[model samples]
Target: MDFLTLLQLLDTTVRLATPLLLACLAGLYSERAGIFDIGLEGKMLAAAFFSAAFAYSTGSVWLGLLAGIGVSLVLSGIHGLASITFRGNQLISGLAITMLAGGMTVLIAQDWFKQGGRTPQLEGAARFEPITLPFAETLREVPFIGPLYYELISGHPILVYIAFALVPLTWWILFRTRFGLRLRAVGENPASVDTAGVSVVALRYSAVMICGVLCGLAGAYLATALQAGFVKDMTAGRGYIALAALIFAKWRPWYALWATLLFGLFQALELRPDLIQQVIGVKVQVQLLGALPYILTVVILAGFVGKAIPPRAGGEPYVKER
Candidate 1:
């Protein structure tokens, strides 16, 4: 393929990667604190539905974003309560959240809008629009750099920039701060943290709630920015894909970018079958292309891409001694 075509594919890759990046990072904070949450997908789906519902009702995208985050936070609290407060099974609690979000979104959409299982198409101010960068049009003819700046690097929603920018911030927060040290410590050995005069439950809850906020952004971006409205199961297993990415990256911040971007490329390729045909000289099945991400997930989880050892105390309930 040519350079411009390659740039176009990359543009799509960036767009598709944004939500995954957000959700993957969400998982990172939760798992890193010893709370094994598999409910990222549920939180995203619930957020997507509620955000769209609120935005359509209020005609304000900001309200919708807040609603999304609010719903995700509630779900995160539920996860925390089940696994932390009650010391229940973390996996079961998380899976229950996913199932709950899946059914609740559709049921509520049909009850509220009567559109089978989707919200009304968001319009005007209720939806996010692409913002052109300051120098994009001015530098459109300055050679390769101009087009690269204009087409690939510019004209995206604010959240796209936010998602990519979080990479460094995540690394900094996880490594450079006192809270980061405690969070990692809590995940590795909660007993030690407790002995050090720290409340392991508090740190784990904070991490899970942070996970909720990021997942909220992911869902809002999906319903308001990427698509015009919410549909049934719009997340389409992206939460699971993000979990796989978390494992693939061995739970590192910078590596999450590469892993999500790699999965995002598959998503982009799914939309650009013509590009695939050009490179391979044959039209490929859409189903086959769509399965690429899942295949990678299985491969990574099966220890194919090096053993991804999770946190030592992951998925274990911390029991304090008398």
Candidate 2:
């Protein structure tokens, strides 16, 4: 492949990787805290529509981003109330939230946007611009490395970098900080944490809220970074993929990133079916490529990679005795 062509491939890979990485981390945050976050897909979809609508209305992507996060927080809070406060089944509550968000987004879009469950397209200026550092720009002029720079980092949206940056940040927060310690403790055994004077309810609530924020960002990234607008059901089951990455990663942030990247590679492969066919010397149908990741997820999980241990007290609400 030519240098520029290689760079373009790499750039496209990063673009594809961004949303998955963000969603994986968002899943990591909630599941790590012992909350089953099956509703992530719904939460992201809701945020995507709201973010796109807000951006279209205010002509400001930043405002849209804020609105997206705000909406996700509200939805997640309702999830917390249902699952945590009412002791509702976590899986059921999450699924309900997902259904609610999906239907609500479409309903609102149809009612207000006048685009039939779609938002207006955004301007180029409204989306995030890729940052090109001076060194990278200079290197781009040098030939091979220039193309490599472009492929790897040159033209990605700001959130792409942030997603990569978050992996280590998540690891540090989960492993090194006191809050992380408490969060993990709660997940592992809220009753124990409660007996020790920590408020389990408070910790779980905070965890879900953080989940909301990250999922909101994931949604906004999908709408603003991956595409310039929103459509009905735009998440396309990526949220489920993110949850799979969490389970596959065994709840480690760095491992989650690796898992997400593998899925991203699968997606990149699907997007360019001809390349895979040429490399494999067989004609692989587009449908097969699309199904590959989920198939692999089931296979990997069944084999018990990383032992797939969930939090001991996951999905259980804590109620202290008076």
Candidate 3:
């Protein structure tokens, strides 16, 4: 691709990657705390529908975001209660939650909005407008930094910045802080953490809480920032893709960023159907581009990622005595 085309591709990559990054980090937090949450898709889908529904009704994106977070947190609580408190099977609980959301979001949307499983298109304050960073305009005339900043780095919604910022913060939280130490400890060996007076249940619940909020942001961004409104199955399989990225990155926060960006690049390729055809003399179907995440998931599952070991206690319901 040409330089301008490359820049455009990268810009789209950043936007597309933001949600994946958010969801990936969410999974990182949960799995790192010994929780295997397969319902990331569910929480995000529910949050997307609720955020768009509320935003359309209230004409406020902030309200929409809060609504999204609220629903996601509720789902997270259910997961926590089932797996951590009641000692239910984590995988089953997560799958049930996902199915519940898949049905409930569409059902509720149809009953309330009558838009065939979607809210009315959001507008004005209901949407997130891109914010131009400082000096973006002034630096537009400068050398390489100018176009790069103005076109690629600046003029994104605030959540984009937040998603990128969370990488360093997540690293710090997982590696630098005492709570982080305990969290990882619980994931690796809950008995040790419990022996040290830490509550394994509490740590896992906190991880779920953080996962919920991040997934909420990811979903909200899908409805209010990336698209104008929510659609049926809007999140698609991004939640699963995030899970795969978590595996691909070996649960490292910084690697999650790069992994999500790689997937986002595939998504960006969907927008330019002719570009790939021109480069390779073979046309690629835009719809098939969506399968990249699934392909990656399969590859990872098939042991291409042999060294990507998960937390020792992952997916096991922790019984304090056991």
**Which one is best on TM-score?**
1
Q: List the residue pairs that clash in candidate 2.
A: 140-146
Please tell me which model should have the higher lDDT, number 2 or number 3.
3
**Least well predicted 10-residue stretch by lDDT in candidate 1:** 292-301
For lDDT, candidate 1 versus 2, the one ahead is 1
Worst 10-residue lDDT window for candidate 2 reads 1-10
Per-prediction TM-score: 0.97, 0.95, 0.96
lDDT tens digits by residue: candidate 1, 22-98: 99999999999999989999999999999999999999998999999999999999999999999999999999999
lDDT of 1 at 162: 95
How does candidate 1 fare on TM-score? Answer: 0.97
Task: State model 3's lDDT.
Answer: 0.93
lDDT of each: 0.94, 0.83, 0.93
Clashing pairs in 1: none
Point out where model 2 deviates above 4 Å. Answer: 1-6, 304-306
Residue 141 of model 2 has an lDDT of 71
Error of 3 at 286 (Å): 4.5
